[model samples]
Target chain A: MKKLLLATCFLMAGSGTLFAQKYMTRTGKISFNATAVHSPEKIDAINNEVANILDAKTGDIVFQVLVKSFKFERELMQEHFNENYMESDKYPKAEFKGNVANVGEVNFSKDGTYNVKVSGKLTIHGVSNDVTVPGTITVKGNALSAKAKFSVVLKDYKIEVASMVADKLAKEATITLESDLTQK
Target chain B: MRKSLLLSVLSLGFVTVSFAQTDSLMNMLNSGAPVKNEPVAATFKATRIIDGSSVENLGAGVLDFRISHRFGDLSQGSQNFFGLDNATTRIGLDYGITKWLMVGLGHSTFNKEDDGFLKIKLLKQKKTGMPITLSYAGSVSVQTTPAPTLPTGDTWLFSNRLYYTNQVLIARKFNDWLSLQLMPTIVHYNLVDSSKFSNNTVAIGIGGRIKVSKRIAITGEYYYRATNADMTYNGQKTYNALSLGIDIETGGHVFQLMFTNSQGLTDRTFIGQTTDSWGKGALHFGFNISRVFTVVKPREFRDTKATSW
Candidate 1:
C-alpha cells in the first residue's frame, strides 16, 4: 500500500509538468539594421536560424542564435562582422532569457492578439545587458506568433567599430524578430 | 522500514525535477539539434602568402588590383643606393569569377612579360571532418622583349618566349594563429639557356603565416628546385628562392613588405632562373600592395527577398 501511494505521487508530479503549455520554433527570424543615417551602404543582416521557446504557464521565454549564422549583403562584411566584431570563434552564441510581464492578461484559448512587455537579459559578443521591449502575441487556433522590435547600443556590448568605418556603421542597432511557434 | 526510506528518497528526487524544468527550456530547444557542417573561413588573410599563391580566395564579385615592386640587389653596395636604384614593377588585376574560381592578368616590367592565370578551388576545410583546403593554379607567361642576339645559324622562334606553370596548393589552418601550405609546382620552358638544364623544372614550395595581431601577420616561403640545381646561366649558379614578408591589413587594402632572393614575379623566372643566393646577401626588397573592390552585391542587398531560408 505504501509503494502504490508513492507511485501515484510520482505520476501526479510528472503530469503537472506535462500539462504545462509550451510553444517552440526553430526557424525564428531575427534581423538587425545598423546603418548610419549618413551612410550610403546598408549595414544590415538577418539570421533565420534563431531558436525560441515560450512557456505559457510561467511566462518564461528564451531565444538563442548563432552569431556566425547572420547573413549580410556583402560577404566581406559578414566576414568582418564574425571575425572582428563578434569574434564568433570565441563567443559563438547570442541569447536572451526573459519573461512576459503581462502574460496573465492574454487569453490563450481565444483567437486574439495581446500586447506584452518582455524584460530579459540579452547577451551579445560575450556581454550581457538587461532590456525591456514591447511585443505582440497572436493566438489563432493552435498557433502562436510573436513579433517584437527594439534597439541596442553597440557600445554596451563592447562591439568596437574601427575608425575607418566609423562613418558607415551606426552606433545603435535596431533589431526585429518574428516567430511562428506550435504548442508542444 | 526499507520501503519507507526508499519512498522518501524518491520523493526528494521528484522535488529536484520540478526545479530543473524552469532551467531546461534552453536545453530542450537545443536537444536533437542537427549538427552543421560549416566551412572554415579566413584560413589566410590574403590570396598570396608570400611569393606563392595561398589557398585563400577572394569572395565572388570582388576585384583586386595588385602592384608588386622589387628593387635591385642589396649586395650592390652604396653605389646603387642600397639596391633602390633599379626597380621592377608588375601590375596585376585579379577578379573572382565565382566563389571557387579566380582569374588574373599581369604585366611585369623586368621581362616585358604579360601573364594570365586561373586559380580554382577544389576542396575547402570544414570546422569538422575535413582537414585540408586544396586549390590549383595554372599560368602562362609570354616574353615580349626583343629576342636576344644568338650565335650564327642559331634560330629563335616565337614559341621560345612562352612559358607555362602549374601548381597544386595544399594548405591547412591548424589553429587561429597558424596556417601552413605546400605547393607542388612544375614550370615548362620552351627554350633553355643550356642543354644541361631540363625544359621542365619541378619544384616544391613550403610557406607559412603566423598571425601576430588582428591586422598584422608574419609570412615566409621557400621554393626548392628539383631540376637543374647545379646548372649555371651566364657563369652564375642557380639558387633556390627564399622570401620573408610581413602583411598589414587595413580595410580594403593589404600591404605586404618582403625580402627575397628571386627578382622575377612569374614562376618561370623566379623558380627556374633565380641566380641570386641568400647566402651572398643578394636579396631584393620588395612590396606588394593589394586593394579590393566589391563589384556585385549579395542576395540580401537585392530588391526582392527570394531566399529560401
Candidate 2:
C-alpha cells in the first residue's frame, strides 16, 4: 500500500509540472492598419478579445481571433471588411499555430526579455500561409508577455478589393499583436 | 511479492491516467477553438427586400437614407411611356438607436401621407443556439390630403385619416445563398368604407432572397390579405401585392429594382389599398435606393487618434 501511494503521488507530481508549463490569456490585443498610397484613405481596426496560449515546455504557441471582433473607425468599413473582404460569416475565425524557432535561447525561469523568431501557419479567410516573424518574449516572475509585428499581403489571403476603390486600399496590411499570459 | 505486484499495476494505471490528462490539455491548447459568439451575417442585406420589410436592421448609430418610387401601372400602355410618365415616390430616413431598436420616418406622394415606424429586434440568430431572428415593427401613417366634399354627410374626423400597422418578422438563413422570412401583419384603418372593407386587415407577408453572386441577390416578396371581403374602389377589386426585385450591393449603398402590382410604398397603402391586378398586366416598375452613413462613432473608437490602428 505504501509503494502504491508513493507511485500515485509521483505520477500526480509529473502531471502537475506539465500543467505548470502552460500559460494562457483571453484578452490579448491585435490591431491592423492599411494605408493607401495615393489617396488619404486609411483603414484600421483593433481586436481586443484574442485568445492566446503558450506552452513553455515545448515553446509552442497558438493564437485565435474572431474576425467579427475587429472594430474599425468607420462602421461602414468594418461592415465591408467582414462582408466583402473577410466573408466572416463563412470564415469566422483567424488562427495561428507554431513554435518558437529559438526556444533554447530563452530561459523561462529567468526574468528577462528575449528576442525570438516564430514560424507558424496562419489561417485567415479560410486560407492558410506559412509565416515567419520576429517577436519578443518577456518574463517577469510568473507572468509572460509576448508581442509581434508583421505585414500580410492581402492577395495571399485571397482578400480582394474592387478596382473602383482599389486605390483606397493598400496591398499589404500591418498587424500587431500583444498578449500578457499568466502561468496556468 | 503479491503486494509489490499490485503496487506496480496501480502505478501503471496512475501513469496512464496522468498521460491522458496531459495529452488532452495540450491538444486543447494547441487547437484553441476561437472563443467567439459570431452571429450570422447578411441574412438579408437591406432593411426591406422589396415591398415588405426584411429581417435586417441598420447597425447602431447608423443612418439610412432611402428613396423608393413606383411608377404607374403598365396597363396604361406605351402612350403613358409604360407607366414611367407618372410615379409615386417615398423618401424615408431610418436610424438605428441601438443594436436592437430602429426608428424610421417617411413621406409618400401617394395620399400625401407621412409615415413613421419603430422596429425592435426580439431575437437574433447566433451560433450559440438561436435558430432564427425575430423582430417586431409598428407603423403609423397619417394622410394629409383633404377629405372629399360629401353631398350630405358628417364632417371627416381627424382620427379617420390615421392608419396603423403591426408586424412580426421572422427570418432564417438556411445557407450562404438562401434566406427566407415570414411576416404576420395587421393593418388598421380608422375610417374604412364599412360596406366594402373591414376596419382591420390581416396579411401574411412572405419574402425570400437567393444570392446570385457576392454582391447581387434575387429577392421576391408577397403579401396575401386574409380577409375574404372584396375591397372595391370605383368598381375595381383590389388585388394582393406581389413584388420581384434584384438587390445590388455596392460599398455604402444598396440598390433594389423591382416590379409589383402595388403602387403604395407604405404597409397601410400596400396591404390595405392595393388596387392593381397582376393578371391584368398592371405591374408597375419601381426601385429603392438606400445609402448608409455613420452618424456616431462606436464608444470604443470615439478617440480619432486611438482609432488609427
Candidate 1 per-residue lDDT, tens place, B1-309, comes to 777686777767666655544358888877845567777888887888876788888788888899999899999999999899988888999999899999999999978999999899999999888899999999999999998899999988999899999999999999888999999999898877788778888999999999897778999999888876676655688898999999987656789999999888887778877888899999999999988776765655567453312
Q: C-alpha displacement of A82 in model 2, angstroms?
A: 3.6
- What 10-residue stretch in candidate 1 chain B is worst by lDDT? B300-309
For B116-194, candidate 2 gives per-residue lDDT tens digits of 9999999988877999999999999999999888677688788988999999999999988899999999988887765
List ranges where model 1 is wrong by over 4 Å.
A1-20, B1-22, B77-81, B148-155, B232-236, B304-309
lDDT of 1 by residue, A1-184 (tens): 7665868686677757654578888889999989888775678899988899888877889999998889886666788798878899889889998899899987888989999999989999999999999999999887899999999999999999887788789999999999988887
Compute the TM-score of each model's chain A versus the native chain A and list the values: 0.93, 0.96
DockQ of each: 0.38, 0.40
Give the Cα error of residue B155 in candidate 1, in Å: 6.1
